[model samples]
Target: MTANNATPPAPPVPSDAVGEGLKAAFRFHPAGVAIITATTDRGPSGLTASSVSSVAIDPAAIMFSVTRATGSAGAILDADSFIVHLIDGEHAELAQNFAVSGAERFTEAQGWTMRETGEPYLPAARVALRCQTLHTVTVGSSVVVIAQVLEVIEGTRGEPVVYLDRAFHSVATA
Candidate 1:
């Protein structure tokens, strides 16, 4: 068929079906859970996330997606920096706290603190990555935030918290 050079024809599908079919076709993949935190003028706020991932290494960039309306969103935006706490296997409570909605999320523990900018992060996590926001992109109902690593705190190397198929899994150590 001869093709027009002006524009490409759009593929056709039921509008609402896109969202529904997407959830089914999405094969659940296991991912480590983390609590990303940043300080807000209202106090501190954060949320539990399993979508955090490493994006680049030369500039030490990482990416994580959070819901657009999440309380943590405003705080992270306000501070312009954050700390990603890769929780160890023993931190189910902390995970639950950050996963739930409330004002007490910031005060759940005594040791969570920022490195240089006073952003909140769990001191006892398997790894604590302090990052400054570099870019943001909107996808679906969330925002993909790309951050530049500022510093890192290495703690007890243990089984990190993993989420798979809507449940928690433990990482095996060799």
Candidate 2:
């Protein structure tokens, strides 16, 4: 309250402070892990993402954000379709591999295979959603992608993998 008995105006927040605050807030928020793969002109490209979320049910739409539209992210943005693999704790190594830059990807040991439709698929994932990109919106340095789920491929079920506090964790069921 001010001397006049009126509410005081809030101080303006710096852009960097807002960004850091958001990062800190999300660091404590648990998010599901997903490996997104696509076929590019160079070869197969993929990356681990924690932002995959369902947007619609009837059209089966989903969305995820990429901080940079390069490497696997660039390939995904350029490609018409891609695969979103919902991974579990058993595939944590695979998720880490994709998350790292210049890491060996799509290796035979990783159980990665190309579907006839041309997108890279990971059979080890608990569930794989074949998606066709519907739109992309640029938000600062990040690109938010909205895709339509074309097919749902079910695989072996297990404890789900989540990311929190900068690490991978497995959720135990009751």
Using lDDT as the measure, the top candidate is: 2
Q: Give per-model TM-scores.
A: 0.83, 0.89
**Model 1 C-alpha RMSD to native:** 4.3
Number of the top-ranking candidate, with TM-score as the measure: 2
Q: What is each predicted model's overall lDDT from 0 to 1?
A: 0.77, 0.89
> What are the per-residue Cα lDDT tens digits for candidate 2 across 9-57?
7668558889899999999999999999999787888989999999999
RMSD of each: 4.3, 6.0
| Candidate 1 residue lDDT tens string, 1-174 | 345678877768558888777665543677788888887778778888888899899899899887788667767766867888888777756777778776356554545655567887677788889899898887667787889998888966666667776677877765
Task: Provide the global lDDT of candidate 1 against the true structure.
Answer: 0.77
Give residue 46's error in model 1 in angstroms: 1.0
